[model samples]
Every structure is written in structure tokens, then in C-alpha cells.
Target: MINLKISEPNPRESVREYAYRILSENILDLVLVPGAAISEKEISDVLSISRTPVREAFIRLSQEGLLEILPQRGTYVSKIDTEQIAEFKFLRITLEQAVMKLACSDFPQKLQEQLCNCLEKQSICVKKRNHEQFFIFDNMMHDIIFTGCEKSYIWKIIQEANLNYARARVLDLSSRQDEIEVLFAQHKEIVKAIITKDTSLGENIIVRHINKVISDVDDLQKQYPEFFK
Candidate 1:
């Protein structure tokens, strides 16, 4: 049986939106593992809501390639697509490297402080072996960079198209906790590059940091053969 955390909908959020958000988050977090069978009725019952919203949410997720619906079979969480992951990685590296270069030129002081605070928390999470929180802050740090560079919309675009890459990253971090410190160090270098206005260094670190997952794809697929396409 699937166990989903039930929560009240956010203010002004439609039931359909709420369902989509919750289900998509679970799918991304790997709580709803890849290729796991699911159903609209099952999700609706789990969330204590009617099936209509859940069905609508399922449709949206399917459009995003996060859910697969069969005419006679059942709904299943989609497997991570390696080809899509590579494409998204290429998109992210291209856009983010540009953003990092812009950030090095003129990142706001307030955002820079926020990045420092996020890194401090990330450091603590690393010390406590908290890969989950580290992952959260890892994304937060990059978001800050985009926001500082005034490219927030690009960040949103990347995120909207990043489902597979995001899941793959979570898998990588969860399966290989030992690499967390190395990631943390690279993050520090990224921040240092931005603060010191080193555009070349910033670009290099961003590419390397983002590509780290691509480099590990072979091993990840080997370990979790069922999770990928």
C-alpha cells in the first residue's frame, strides 16, 4: 500500500492544484518510486479527496513525463529517462553557466548573505549526515544565484523541465552519501567565485558541479537498474 502524507491545501489553492503538487512532489522525492503502480482512486482515498482532482492531477503529471497512464493497465510512476536527463543537464549547464558569469559581475549583497547562510546550514547538514536537507540547500544555493543575477524566470524554466534530472540527482545523493562533502566543497568554490568576481572560475565550477551527476549515471544505472530507462 502507498502511504502519502496528508495535509491541508494551501490558501486559495484549488483541489486539483493541491493534488498535483502533492503527487508530483512525492514522485520527485522518490516516495512514489519509479514504475510503482498507482491509481486515481487510490490517491484520492489516500488524500481524503474525490477522484476527479486526483485524475486531473494525474493527467498533468503525465504531460510532464512523471506519470505513465495505460488504457487498461494502471497508472505508474515513470522511470527516469536517461536521454531526457542528459538534455536537461545540457540546458541547465548552458543557462546556469551564463547566469554564474552574470552573478560574478554584480550579485546583490543581500542575496550573497543569503547564500552564505544557506551554505552554513548546508555545512551543518553535512556534519549531521543529512543528505535530504543538504539537497534542499544545494538547490537553494543555485536559486539564489539565479535570483541575484535577475534570471529568476530562467530558473523556473529549468525547474519546470528538470523532473528527471531532479529525481536522478536525488537517487545519486541518497545512494552515495559519501560524495556529499565533495559536493559541498564545490558549492563553496562556486560561492567564492561569485563573490570574488571570477567569471571563469564560476563557469568552471557550475559546469563541473552540474555534470557530476551525468558522470555518475552509469554507476547509478548499474546499482538501480530498474529505476532508469
Candidate 2:
């Protein structure tokens, strides 16, 4: 048996939680690609941690719908289920639309400044073609808006779904440069709608933006068939 012990404790959690965070991020970012075989031994070697913590992490991700553990076989990243994606789309659109509406009515100036700052960073990343930076900024931008909504439970769900989607999107965006300009333009529109308190326009913009993701899923499946299979 692999010995899974930590000499010290993490400020936020036990060793198991730390392990879960690292492994979950890797899986969600496609660092561990879907359908790519993984073993507890490999995880132990790579993380320099024991199988217990790794197993704990795997269980957490499996609960989050990002990994699968076979009874007798090795663990694997979960396949991209189109039906689940569709459900995600429906829930995200409806909830985010409502959230945007709330933000239009209640967002403070400080929040607007933060969002604009995130947008500026996005523009800089685009000009430099720094995808890693752009990806982080992309997340920050939505996060700011989601925070402005002030719906903690809904935000939690959206955050989870976004994490799952990010792995696939990072791959898709790496090849789809044309999408960059279009996405930025929509971001501007969303910001403008929020600033002007145009709830309808903001909601419409988000709906369209999410639709593009739905459109791109087919391409993602084609490019990374094994991941999706």
C-alpha cells in the first residue's frame, strides 16, 4: 500500500483537499486529457503524494462530473456528454440572464471599474496573442459579472460548469483565432449593456455568446475525438 501522509497541514484544508484542488484543476484544464489513461501509481509518482490523497482527489472530481472511476479498471477523464452540455447551456443561459438583469439594476461603480479593468487586460492579451493570459482574463471577466449578480448558489453552479467547460474551450480557442475578435466584441457589448442598464440587451448578448459555444462543440469533438469518445 502507498503511504499517504503529510508532514504538515494546509491552511485551508487537509492534505486531501490540497490534492483534490491540484488534480481537479489539471483534469478540468485538460492537462489530463479525457480518455487518457491514468493510474494511482502515476499520480503518486507525479504529485509525489501517496495513493490515499490521490484517490481522495479522484473521488472529489468524480463527484464533480469530471472523472470516472472504473470498478476494476483505471480511472479516466469523463467523456463530454452532449446532453449534459445542453443542460448546462440551458441552466447557464437562464440563470446568467437573470443575474445580468439583477446586476443592471444593482451593480455598483466599483464593480464596473473591476470589470472594465478585466476587459482592458483581455484586450492586451489579445494584442499580444498570449492565450494563457487571455484564458485567465476570460475567466476573470465572467467571474466579475457573476459576482455582481450576488446570487451565491447560482454562482456556485455556474462556476462549476465553467470549470468543466474550460478544458474543452482552451483547446478550441488555441486553434480558433477568428473567434477572439468576435468574443471580445461581445464582451464589450455586455459591458455596455450593463453600464446602460439595458437588461434585455445584456441577456440577449449572453445568450448569443453561449450559442457560439454550442456551435463550437462539434469542432471540438472532431479535433479531439478520443477525448470526447
Candidate 3:
């Protein structure tokens, strides 16, 4: 049996939107796991919604490269694409390195504090072995940096373009629990560099931080070959 925790639909959300949101969140969070079989009828039955809305949601996720609709074989969650992951990593490294430089020059003090708070939450999540919340706070910290540098739109672009990269990250965190502390330490150093206006340090940290996953891709593939394309 599929173990989906169905959320109540929001008052203003249409059935389709609600279905899409829940399904997408589950996919990104790896609850649906890459390459797992999924069907509109099954999801509709699970969510207690009409098949029409569920079908629509599946089509949308398919367009976003989150679902593979095989003609006769049936639909399944999309596997992680390492090529796309490497592409997005390059894009992120280039743009975020520049953002780090800008942040070092004049990041807002308010945002700086928020980054520290995010780090503290991440620390707690690490201690508790809460990979999900740790991932959330990790993204939140980076979002704060982009907001502080007045480049939030750029951050949004990265988020939208990096879904595959995001899944790869979640996979890494879920599989390699031991690395959480190392990631937390890197985030701390990133915040420190910004606070002290250390552009050189901040830029270097961003590169290393973003490239860590790519460095592990070979090992990750060998360990979970089916999860990757």
C-alpha cells in the first residue's frame, strides 16, 4: 500500500491545485521515491478525489519531468538525471558565487540574523536526525542570502530550474546521515563569511558547498543504480 499522508485541501485551493501540490511535495521529498509506479486512479482513491483532478495533476507533474508516462508500461516517478544535476550545479555555482560577492559587500543585518537563526535550527535538526527539516532550513539559509542581496527573483529561478538537483540532494541527505554535520558546518562558515564581509571566503565556500553532491554522484550511482538515469 502507498503511504501518502493526504493533506486537507485549503479553502481557496481547487481540487486540481491541491492534488498537484500534495503529489509534487511527496515526489520532491522522496516519499514517492524515484521510479516507483504511480497511477491516477490509485492517487485519486487515496486522496478521495475525482480521477479527473488527479489525472490533471499527473499531467502537470509529467511536464515538469517529475513523472514518466510510459505508453503501455504505466506511469512512474521520474528517476534522477545526473546530467541535469550537473548542468544545474554549474548554473547555481555561477550565479550564487556572484550573489555571495554582492552579499559580502552589503548584506542586510536583519537577513544576516535570520541566516544565523536558520543555522541554529539546522543544528538542532542535525542532532535529532531530522533530514527533512534540515533540508528546509538549508534552503532557507540560502534564500535569506539571496533576499539580503536583493536578488530574490534570481533565487526563485534557481529553485524552479533545479528540481532534479533538489531531489539528488534529498537522496544524499537521506542515504548519508553522517554528512549532515559537515553540511551544517559549511553553512556556518558561509554565514560567517557574509557577516565578516569576506568575499573571497564566501565565494570559495559557495563553490565547495554546491559541488559536494557532484563529487559524490559516482558513489551515489554505484550504491543506488536504479534511482539514477
The candidate maximizing lDDT is 3
Residue range 79-155, candidate 1, lDDT tens digits:
99999988888899999988998999999999999999999999999999888789899989988999998899889
Give candidate 2's error at residue 54 in angstroms. 0.7
CA RMSD per model (angstroms): 1.1, 3.9, 1.0
TM-score of 1: 0.97
Candidate 2 Cα errors over 4 Å, as ranges? 1-13, 162-164
Whole-model lDDT for model 1 versus the true structure? 0.91
Query: Is candidate 1 or 2 superior in lDDT?
Result: 1
Q: All candidates' lDDT scores?
A: 0.91, 0.77, 0.92
Report the number of clashing residue pairs per model: 0, 0, 0
Model 3: per-residue Cα lDDT over 121-213, one tens digit each? 999999999999999999899899999988999999999998888888888988996879878989999999999999999999999999987
lDDT of 3 at 156: 93
The positional error of residue 77 in candidate 2, measured at the CA in angstroms, is: 1.5
**lDDT per residue as tens, model 2, 1-229:** 3222323445877667877876776666566777766777877786677899988888888887888899898788887676677777888889878888887777878989998999999899889877767878877777788777767666666777765466667676677877777778888998999999998898899899877777798888887777774
Of 2 and 3, the candidate ranking higher by lDDT? 3
The residue pairs that clash in candidate 2, if any, are none
Candidate 1, clashing residue pairs? none
lDDT measured at residue 22 in model 1 versus the true structure, 0 to 100: 95
